[model samples]
Target chain A: MSPVETGRRGAAPDPSFAPEPAGAVPVIVSRDLTVGYKLHRERKRLTALRDISLSVNAGEFVVLVGPSGCGKTTFINAIAGLVQPWEGSIEVNGRPVTGPGPDRAMVFQDYALMPWRTVESNIRMPFELQKLGLSKQEIDARVRRYIDLVDLTGFEKSFPYELSGGMKQRVGIARALVSEPDILLADEPFAAIDAMTREAMQGELERFVAKTGQTVVFITHSIDEAITLGDRVVVISYRPGQIKEVVDVNLPRPRFDYDVKSLPEYSELRDHIWRLVKDEALQTAHGAK
Target chain B: MSTPDLSDGGSISEATDPNRIEDTEWTAGEAWERYGSKVVTVINLTIFFIVWELFARSGAINQLFLPTASNMFLALWDGFTTTAPPGAVISGSIRDHLLYSLTNLSIGLFIACVIGIPAGLLMGGSKYVEKILSPYVWALASLPRIALVPLFILFLGFTVKMQITIIALSAVFPIIINAWAGVKTTDESLLAAARVFGASRAELYVKVVLPFTLPFIISGIQQGIGRGLIGVVIAEIFGGSKGLGYLITRAADTFNSALLYAVLLLLVIVSLTLIQITRSLEAYVAPWRRVDKV
Candidate 1:
């Protein structure tokens, strides 16, 4: 292929990354979504998302990237059913989203673990909640397996305070995955870690997602992260966020030790998203509607 | 003056400094000066006692008005085993009064625990409920429990039931309030995490919420126990005729200064023991919270 085609590889002519399956439908669907908050008694609303319609296939990794306060997190929260959309519907596996359910698990930005519990207990929480007539041995085995998966085997007895930020996030990831939900939603899960730690965690999380074949909706401000980790990148506009563009990343599978930042395709995708985000960010900063 | 010897030899040498011994003496003196206040406290108490004993023995004050410490000790010994009389036994003996007061305190505390914990959980968990009831809690807390003795006696009819009500009412509020605050202030994200994990409401309350609130509950109980002791004593003094308060009142009426002093001492002992027990419970429940010395 020519250099021009390779550079423009991330931006397909289709201009929509809503996964088109050869056979199956998306696990999560948001149609013409608008999410917002009511400001005062006058019912003045600040729209966070506007007309965001996307489809996340059963095992696809979709990245939602934009400037801070651009409604990326709000969008994911809506998908998690933590909040209701001002307009439109979000459905998971053909079921209309109403409230939080065990079918969709969330890995929060702050690693929001129960501090009073040990790592193992945190991972076993879903089982306990479902009251799945599983025997003690079965629960223990599942907890042990996830603990191993997260490489926190020996640290199972440690509380959240005793663990480092990255370690705590690892535990949070394990806890989210232990439920084996149909979809995993992460809202800036690695934002709190240092640069080196964040990169390491991102790689680890990418590998885990790749192995599990779980549907993921990851929200982040990092453009390079979006390219490196996502099979498709969804660019969102600032306050009253609407989807600017969706670009498919046709990168090879088992994407390891690959520095997308150095690739021309990566730089091109990054610049395209930057153009859309920078204008919106400037408008928000300058108080332009 | 002869030269000081510097070595074990019999011959005198002029090298030894005689001030070294004086420096050692001064160091010892400074050490004692640093600890001098402890010694001074004992001396001051001894002097006060001597003055008191002298005044008592001289009858500068009437013997019936105030008893010497020796007489108080004798009265305490007699209250345990003997009755002062022309063959009349003391019905309100020291052992009897202690047992009566202890039973009242125990039953009251049990009732307080039964009421305080669940009430605290409800108030703490529900903001609307807490808001509606806060005024009543404030009124109860600020009310002088002693002044309510007559009301309690009137309502409950001067029985042990009246005394228990006084003690429970006095103690339960603090525990409930503290537990409620602790539960309400528990980390919100923790609860959210529990919910996402699919934990049932009951399991969330049992595992996450309760452990976090326990330290506060224990602290409230400690404070409440101290208040409860006050309640028992006040209840006895106001109307009851079976506890240490009754014992002291009767002794006071007959000009039995020695007996009155002895009963007052017993009351102090009971209060001290209860305080010590609560403190130990605090330490036992939260040993992980203790800071280690370097």
Candidate 2:
């Protein structure tokens, strides 16, 4: 079936779509998360984050926007169970993260698709990791389904090298989705793509979250992107980052392309985020050593 | 635009027919021209042999000491096809000696590879291992391995085992050092990606590290094989009953220059064949190297 038809069915209010209380929980919860790194030859401690508490309700689209090295990546890594928070605890579905787990898939800034693997095989990597006892046919079926979802039907056999920047990110997205993770944490997933392709990807991601009801934590520098894709935008301060402001985007559901940026609410949200981030971005430019 | 000069009489001949002008075409001469270099190589070898034969016949050196190129080939043929002079049997025939030498070379090389790759991986994998082993490996690798022939015979006795031991010892360091360096130099980011994907330690080695280090290891293996062959020949010359090295030694002792030259020719052929095989294998395995067309 077509993606639009599939989206209409998925986003439609179905009784079955409600969270099953037994397994479903808040996708992510972080309490006073502090991440730090040991500084160079001097051996002084450098704290990248301080007492950051945040939680995303299941299916919420959250965006973390800040200047470079604002500890956005460090925060996401904590959530993905790659980085251990020095001070606070992080739980995905009430289980404290120890290390990288299959339940939380990460979309890295560089799109971390294995260079040796083809698009289809890259998407199937999670399945390989799972070592699921399913037959090859079953694996192939799920692979085809997700490949179609990302609008990459025929490009399966092509290697990552053969793809454009945007297509590689789509393959990255497809890889993250194939694992069926409750929380998808992306670190500047679209920032690497060209402007036109980034816009298209942003739109595609919006539709994807709406359809799947999968909680997403996207990190980006683009203010409009933050305002557009996020259900709630979390603005972070410069080095030794802390939560500056958490602005709720109460724009209408099923965000249409024409009405998206043109709305008054979108402008107000954009301006608010800009005010918070502008100083930090300027601080970075002014050679803040 | 006026047709740019496609006009160096480039035999790729779409230009010759107006209707087929836009289509790609292969000229007959071009196909033959591609094979021309191989024919030239054969002609070069022929000329080289002719010069060597003319020089030897002109008695530039003592005739007994320096046989003509044709005489060397004849000596080799006579070693195999003809009976020995009355009451004198050649210590071992050419085929027997060549086989014995080849067997020792092959066995030694196999043992070297078996030990070297894992040792290299371990040294490469940990900083502690590298720190401990780096000096020792470098020291061994830099040693004049040919000088150890007598030492190998003393330790292992004058047997094939002694020759094999010398060969293995000579060859092992290159493979180990290269393998270690190859693994150590693999991209850290790639490993991080694998770790984040929840790859097990074994999977990281087998899938991620091994493939990346393969080219380096292959180079090491080729070097080791060549070194190992030299070591075997040297060891056998010191104390061997039946091998190419023994034949060369016996001939030199008796001043049988023609037989010595013949055996040397055979050794050259064997070594050349081995080098060509390794090179072909390297090209086959690393097709990603842009220079290798096939």
Candidate 3:
């Protein structure tokens, strides 16, 4: 199946395709999360985040948007266990994250696929990580399935460099999804891609997420992308970032199915987010100067 | 940890999977393109030999001192076909000399690889190891390795054993330094990606670090082989050992320009063959590099 048509074909657990209730069990939770880095020069601690708290229900797609260097990345990195919180705790599936775990997968902006490995091997990464006791045939079968899902079946033997930016990120998505992680955290995965490819990927991601119903935490500076894919858009503050507002996107499933920005509600949501972010950006620029 | 397989009974779309893409046109184009380069290379080689032959016959240089190209080939044929004089200590045939020199080269290079690879890996992996070894490596690599010949002659005498030591010592530095550089420069992002995917330290090295370092290590081997060739010639020329280098020395003493030119041609051919072999080996191990140098 083509990537844009992926999640649509899979059977949905809820045929009604309604927005999940707010009281649904949280798949990911962060409590008063704060992170700081030790600036070795003069031995000072530079705090990147301060007392941030948020929770995403199971199967929810949450987008976190802010200006650059606002610790949006820090928050997701903490959620991925790539960065440790100096204060508070972040949990995935009721377990506190100590380090990167198998239950979670992250899609980085750089499309961090191993250059030496082919598309097939990159997809089979999690299978090879810890021996799953599956036979070689079974492993190959699992790999082939995801390759089909990502519409990369024929390009399995191609190296990452051989692929276009959009395709490489598709492999990155396939690699992340192959592990069947409950929580998918992406760090501005589409930011570096060309505008056209970015739009296509956004739609592809929407289909993938809609079908799988996995909880997603996507970080980006694009308000349009935030409204396009997220169930709720979390507007964050400047450095030492805290949540300034969490705006619910009460849009329909498969937002990429139509021109989302053309909707009346979409404009209001976009304007609302821009108003909050514009003030924060102005304050940050003045503060920097 | 095992993930629940997602496609157990899921419907698979029948689409144009590129894995089954026919290679009919691509294979033909690739082969044609490759052969085009090979033809150019052959033409280039022919032009070089033709110029050299014309220069020789033009009397631009004395034929008695500098043999003509045809004369050199004649001497080479004689060296291969003819046997040594009555009661000689070793065979005088060029084939024997070539084989003898190759034995010393192989043994010396093998020893250098055995010691250099581990030392370089440790140096690259640990700062402590690097700190302790860096001084010695810098000094040894900088030192004129041929100068060690006199000291070696005094202690070990003019034997194959001493020659092997010379070749090994000459080759060791490049192998170690190159391996260290290769390991040190392994892509940082790839390492991070591997770690974030739940690879242990050992797994990270095996899966990511080692494959990334192979090309560097091979380049090191290339340099090591070049140095080893120089060491072999130095040992044979100075120590009067039974190799092609020694034969060249005798030819020089007797003013046998044809034999000297012949030996030089043989050396060139052997070095080219070694280089071709290594290039093929490198392309084999790192096919991804063949694509776009990832």
Candidate 4:
């Protein structure tokens, strides 16, 4: 973890370094992906995403920002193997994705923590679901570490309903991270949280993924959130979502600590992304394709 | 500076001290807010009985039709404390009849749950089962259960078996329908989260669907209890040698209105008690839903 940290931080000062480093391996590769849901009542197929292609390198944080119904979730669902592509292929670690495996974990926007289970039990669920070949002691230790990592040490015995929205999402994060998956897919995980707590949680998430060195595919509707959390912000178009642009963010490590929002380049990047998303957002507001 | 330092330390200690969170004594108003309704109910009931006693003493209504509150209470107390002699015809004790009615109800409920839970779960789990069974379930459930009481009596005679069968049939539909709805409406996001965590199909049902449906099934049983009680009385009133229904009929025929009132009061208590028990059971099994319901 420290080696990756040192390497990324050392190269941050150099503006000439490419966002994708030399010899960097791509962990998620999707090419010409088309995916949709069947409208059985209408007897037609509703395309959510069409002919999309993107590649995420190991340990890179990629944020997809788009309007509502832009199929941002569909892209990650395809990567998580929750949904199959009608056309094209999605590969993870040089293999075609088939189904959800132990190597990938997701944090849901609704903090889909089982209400009946305590925080510790929710964190322990992945171990029970898929065999990770870990001993009882090892699983216990990991669960404890994640509980502490997410600042929920005192809340292990509490159920989801007893927790505030932020605390519940912290349990969600802990549960996802406890598996030590190579990739973390988060779908608007902070969208439901209060603004103040959302910022704090965003900073905490950056610290967490920095320590674990997991490649993150995060989706957000907020431009500020995308800029604050992403190394590459991929703007997606409306309706049948396609990649509009992928912008490299050369800001320093840990933007929260750096007060990167106060910088001129940060404002410029925000404006650029806003301009790109403005039309798509208008179209969505008008309920037009 | 020294004064400021002293005050700052005091405030910080006060903020951090866990002992500061001790419970405070309730004021009169707070106590009233907590239990005012119960006090009001007790006073209201006492006044109601007093009015009833006064009205009965006035003798405006026939004693055969209306009994004094005190006389009713006396009848109830006597019926509860004493038992009928062995081998006696038409036992005068409400205790014997109450016990008989309750026993039949429990057995019928047990049978209803045994048949209803699995049938409902299967219908929810498989589309084919739901399609095949829903029509008959709806047809039977919609037809008034009282209509079937006479039919059951004709089939099995005026016996405990007929009464229990009637109760079971009356209770089973609500249980089946509730369980089916519980399974059908299991939260989509919960299912997705389970699947994303690598839960297999069987594991999804066992872990996700079952716990989520437990409270639903309990509430279903609660409704079933009410319906089963109705079935019990109907079956007994139609034709039976023992039960609260028979006692009611016997008292009415003999013009013993106090005993009739006593039986009616007992039925109300029994129904409310059973419903309350099921409610607590639901709250215990699914505490999360309890908060949401409020």
Candidate 5:
């Protein structure tokens, strides 16, 4: 079955589900959040992000775009509770972030699927690691459903090494969605995929999250991808990163089906983000902060 | 303008249909492709033996140093098919010595694994353990295990205990080092993914690190088997009445050149068989790693 048909059927079983009442309630709030890493060898701390404050509403798709070393990944990692903020605060569900919890999950750029695990086992890893209050049958059903949702019904026994780049990322997507986390954090998830498959995957990602109502914080260097997938594109500055601008994308829902790339408004948003990022990108290229 | 219709389910279904595959009769070329290397190896070894047999018959070299291939095979056959007379000091049959050597090697390897696996795991899992144990491990592993044979002989006296100790000591270092490297080099992204998925520290080790290190440990055992074999022969040669090493020494002392050549051939067969078993074990446990070689 096509992903769209599965997504529709999957959403239909739950009548209480509504497309996120975006802008009505903020799920993630960051206030003066400063996060960095300690260089133990140098006895110094490197600030990857500085004094950043942003609020993402429930079910909103926020894309962070910047050059290399721009702390875009640091922001997402902070949300995932993989790293702590050096100053101020970052909160989820109106509570201060402490560490990784069941409410949040992340997709890595490298796919990061366990090489030893089959597709079915990899998607079931979350339940193995934590108590999700799920019965064995429920977990099995959800794993199978998500596998079908990602159109990987027949490849359940295949290992990561047996898969292509796109198929592996589909497994990554399925794994992240299986836990049904409220917030989905992706760090350059499609960076390694080939260009044609990446376009198709971006569309599928939109459809999946739309049906599931996940608040997504996606990181990317591509302005086109930001405009294509994001509700708001956040442009960040180079080393000791700060938010340069947050450009709202007023494009229609299911933008891939709408062929929004041909729209003049889409080009305008893409060009504006490119302009906002150009100086920082150049500075990054020349090794100047 | 005439691109194939990818959206049509007809071609796609047929391509992926498992039943569409049929077994075809093998042609001469196909049969050759499958078994050519094995046939070549048998023929090459047969020619080698024939040449050796001719040279030995020509008497170009001393029979004491180079026995005829037929004489060597005869000795090997007699050693297997018969047993030494009752109360003989040294058994003439190769079977007894081969059995003794193999049993010692197995016990020694088991003891080595028992000590080595935990030591390697502890070093890899804890920074403090690694710092404390690394210097000693490197020092002992770097020293040729042969150098310690005499010391063990002095300490335990030319007994089975001495031979076993030497074998264990020789085998343990490679296992420890390989397990250590495996744990240390586990892919970082896998760890990150596990963490993000709500794995605790202990879970990370159990679910991520241990599985990742298993293939390494197996390969380490493979190396250990080779080293342990060397230790076995050396220890037995130095001071023991029973093993292939002892047989080799006795055969040389009596100038039984055929028996000496037979023992050497037995050693080669034993080593190759053990190595082949480990290789199969490695491939079975970690089929994903085997993909790259093909």
Candidate 6:
């Protein structure tokens, strides 16, 4: 791609990346966001992200898709306050994020659940951390609510080691949601599970958010997953990753378990994303030069 | 260290499959294996005693050198029930000496743990603390403990103080090394999870670090028990006027083979009982340690 082609990528004023026309303020607005790492051992610098700008409107499901080694995780990690941007800024609710806080709760791919804690305690952690001023009864009630919402009610007393990969991620979702954050940041939360479980988790998550209208910025390399769950799919290019394109899904809410993949609209969006991601992967391989 | 969770990362429901009965009752093959093992152990002990008795009776070995099992048992019974013989240097019953040794062992283990565990935790927690203490800990742990018995005796004399110090010194190294290693080896992933969840430094150590380090501490305690047993015997044989160790030396010095054999048997029993207690303690604190055997 030429310099002009690179510039034309997600730089499209695709209105989809704009604040919702209904006057809801964007929950997250990242401007000129660039992040890099200093390889202290090797005495070199590795740039992970280039100047990228995006706006995520309130209650919107924004999924980031990219090739392997594309800075998708880094972009979300910047929001999670796990990584510092080398340049530019990320504003969560009109304020620049300084560090990890309760405003943004992360669901990691590996389901970072404490093996020793019961599912209820793990889900109840956010309140314990922030001391949210809720009464003990209120916290207990809320914890129970989220546990039921994630269909993990019976297993509330079970440890992470006792849960399956899918069950563990469900607990992770409950934990993240119980915090009642403005933005939910998930980093490939379903990547490790088998295909069948992953499909069901995607459906369960969509159903939960359909009622709650929670804002989620999910990062993944799966184009199909991005198309299935996202209202807008943000495609990042290969490393030193820049926004390549943003595609609007325009799919129905709670679209899961059915033959959603066979729909022409779904297939078209999938094909479009598949091609973008394929091109990005090829570019990453060739760009190594 | 505890054996890590052995569940195969399968579906959580599958991992705790309720229908999967963990059978305590042995199957035909297992029952045969179990009984076969017991029979082998009993047979081996019987063979050892028969050979020992025969060896003494055959005149191949002196009776004093290889006292028959009956003579040893009679001496043990007599020692338990009566006072020491008139010619003996120490006049108390065998019970008195056994109690003396036990007291030393307990006191030694207690002092060693009191000093060693905290030192290990500090060294493991802070690089600066480790830098200050590493040289001394390493030098002490590696030095031949037996050589230091002479120094202890010289400083404290042939008293209980020296005996206890020798035993405590012998037990301290394993506790220090293992406790330090246990803390240092706190799973990085667990710590990261704690940090992301906004756990403060104190909570992180209390909730995450200590529980993870418990198994290592337990294993270290087990090792110290063995070392402490050796220390007790060495101290008694070399210097102390009382304890099972003193009796063993007295029997040897006086050429009372039956008493020597009796004391040796008791020592074996005491060592085995100490090891058994430690093994059970290990099981209590870290049930996950035996996941492989299960």
Q: Which DockQ values do the candidates obtain, in the order shown?
A: 0.11, 0.09, 0.28, 0.30, 0.31, 0.19
Model 1 bad stretches (over 4 Å): A1-24, A36-48, A66-70, A131-137, A221-227, A235-238, A244-256, A264-289, B1-99, B125-132, B200-216, B242-294
Q: Candidates ranked by DockQ, best first?
A: 5, 4, 3, 6, 1, 2
Pick by DockQ: which candidate is best?
A: 5
**Ten contiguous residues with the weakest lDDT in model 6 chain B:** B3-12
Which ranking of candidates, highest TM-score first? 4, 5, 3, 6, 2, 1
Q: TM per model?
A: 0.71, 0.74, 0.86, 0.93, 0.91, 0.81
Which pairs clash in model 6?
Answer: A10-A244, A163-B12, A164-B12
Q: Point out the worst 10-residue segment of candidate 5 chain A by lDDT.
A: A1-10
Report the Cα lDDT for residue B67, model 4: 95
**Which prediction has more favorable lDDT, 3 or 5?**
5
Residue A90, candidate 4: Cα error in Å is 1.0
Tell me the tens digit of each residue's lDDT in model 1 across B145-184.
8888899888988799999999998899889888998898
lDDT of each: 0.76, 0.77, 0.81, 0.86, 0.86, 0.79
Residue-wise C-alpha lDDT for candidate 4, range A138-177, written one tens digit per residue: 9999898777667676668888898888888888888888
| Model 5: residue A224 alpha-carbon error in angstroms | 1.8
Which model is ahead, 2 or 3, in terms of TM-score? Answer: 3
Docking tier of model 1: it is incorrect
Q: Model 1, residue B51: displacement in angstroms?
A: 16
- Candidate topping TM-score: 4
Task: Please give the RMSD to the true structure for each candidate, in Å.
Answer: 15.3, 10.1, 6.1, 5.7, 5.9, 7.0
Residues B209-286 of candidate 5: C-alpha lDDT, one tens digit per residue: 999999999998999999999999999999999999999999999899999999999999999999999989888878
Model 6: CA > 4 A from native: A1-21, A34-52, A65-75, A153-157, A235-247, A268-289, B1-27, B30-63, B69-79, B82-93, B257-265
